[model samples]
Target chain A: MPTIVVDVMPKPEILDPQGKAIAGALPRLGFTGFASVRQGRRFELTVDGEVTEDVLAQARKAAEELLSNPVIEDVVNVAVLTESAQNESQSA
Target chain B: MTAQNTELPLIGDYSTAGPVLTGARIGVVTFPGTLDDRDAARAVRLAGGEAVPLWHAEPDGAAALSSLDAVIIPGGFSYGDYLRAGAIARFAPLMDAIIAAAGGTAGNDAGLGGSAAGLPVLGICNGFQILTESHLLPGSMIKNESLKFLCQDQVLRVENNATAWTREFSAGEEITVPLKNQDGQYVADEKTLDRLEGEGLVTFRYVGGNPNGSRRDIAGITNAAGNVVGLMPHPEHAVEPGFGPDSAAGMRLGTDGLGIFTSVVASIAGGAQ
Candidate 1:
């Protein structure tokens, strides 16, 4: 079964307090040279069979309507998760 | 009056006073993790209206709302506040019906007029989040700027009293109510905020300092038609005399929040006239 991956992030104009707190903690934890940090969410939706355009379109609609709030967050990415990419993400 | 001499008013006390409207059917929606439905229903009963329970997952949203004169989406951590508060609950079947009945559409400007002209709806706290998520109201709620859960007796200025939920209040009336929430800060584009102010759609403004860093100290707002209103404060908690916030009159004697419920009933009654 193939999986659809949706990535969502707080809009740049909106304040990201969680990301700000993480960024503030980096130097205290001995991690240096990082300018800032922005946290986001990634959702993996499993499909029973081959990933099709229709399925991808439905996933996109879901991403816009449910996964990400267009008011404060943006749907950054919506794509099929290839096996190689999944392994790469796991290894990384 | 002394505390001992003050008679505590029980729920449905208005029935003995020859109730204004013959039990306006007000539906209170209960989403998973909702915390204030009971309080909201009590407020309705106290205001001389019948409280009807509506489930979020009701398959026939139209059928559920057909007989309802009004609906309330009370405060709570719906869906455990996952993936942003009220984000997932926005897609519930009941919300779809609410959006339609309140003259709203998904991802559309709330100012646009729709078919249903006057089904009164009030969303409080998490309910306000769902309204924004459903686009029945504009703007979104985020974490408090202090990054802490806020619970306080908040004072609010009634900016507009013509809305269906505020008809009992006079413009600029100050009322105190309990406000408790994590994601209570309301945010929106400057244009939208300006438009809300320009249109007199702002229903409530924090009288004291901004509690959650909400833009312009906005505590509540209503839609274009004035039938739908949303606020972050828990007015339902302040409807009862002994259980409400303190006021200059006496301790726990502030029933200012009752106006919201009474106002709706009055609006319904007036609409039928």
Candidate 2:
């Protein structure tokens, strides 16, 4: 089996209410450090077989169909890697 | 022990304690600025639903499991309130799982299919901010018309009172609750606002006055299906009658907040699936 991964996010243009809220609250908490907090989802999948983009696509399709709202949230970036490759990137 | 499940003792049975929330599995997602996760969980238990806490970074969304019946995105600052309120939270590991489970496969059912059917999702304050950012709700919350951080006990008129979360509220009934946010103003295009008003999509409205200058004095709104609800007021803060906001009539109201959680129980048990 191949591993499947899915990432979710609001279309870039769609304004993030939660992000704005935290942005507004940070100064009050005296912990304003970062510039922005763009909220989105990241999904990781691992299968028994090769983790091909095609397999990942299936998961993406499932996410688009059921998981994400294209009108407001959009899928931006995606990448597929073997367990070793994923580990390499993580270690690096 | 939840009010549902029927496993909990009805009247009194000291020897055999009941489940915490019975079997009403409820989920609470924590974003970076989320400050009310614990309060939300306690409110769920008071209303008889098991609270499942979800995190922004924790992967393996599989933990949501089939046992869950509803989910609550508690209020707080997620991701240090960087760009927008709920913007960063929308990308949390748990959101992907929720989106997949509830969004469902394209052809299956418009609503969440499979085990997520009748899954009631509620967003409060920052949670409400997340719902809009996540596209779970329409319209948006902007800077207060006054551009000031607003915190007050406000009165609101329950508008539709027909959602999975607001079923317990009487339509048009006025209730007081806390409103705290810098950007609580709700706005939308004329058409969308008109449709929302005409379609009875407005859930609750600011009672005495518009706290943050929301469109049409709107405090909350629900989806067409009524399973998903987003609001600016902190219903979770006013569960017990006396402990909650002052009831309209001035009685020793402890927890009106239970109604929100109880509404979830009603939605799952008596939803139009």
Query: Clashes in each model (backbone N, CA, C under 3 Å)?
Result: 0, 60
Q: Please tell me how candidate 1 rates in CAPRI terms.
A: medium
| lDDT (10s digit) by residue, model 2, range B52-122 | 66656654664654557788887767776565577667767666556545543321333324344535778
Candidate 2: which stretches are off by over 4 Å? A1-92, B1-21, B62-65, B104-118, B248-254, B271-273
Q: Provide C-alpha RMSD values for all models, in order.
A: 6.6, 9.8
Model 2 complex DockQ against the native: 0.05
Write the residue-wise lDDT of candidate 1 on A22-56 in tens digits. Answer: 99999999999899999899999999988888999
lDDT winner? 1
Q: How many backbone clashes are present in model 2?
A: 60
**How does each model score on lDDT?**
0.85, 0.70
**Candidate 1 lDDT tens digits, B1-273:** 333224321111222223444558899988788889888988898898988778787778877788889999989888898888998788776777788777777412333233446589999999999888888888998889887898889999999998999999998999999989899889998999999999999999998799888999999999998998999998999987789999888998888899999999998877731
Clash total of candidate 1: 0
CAPRI band for model 2: incorrect
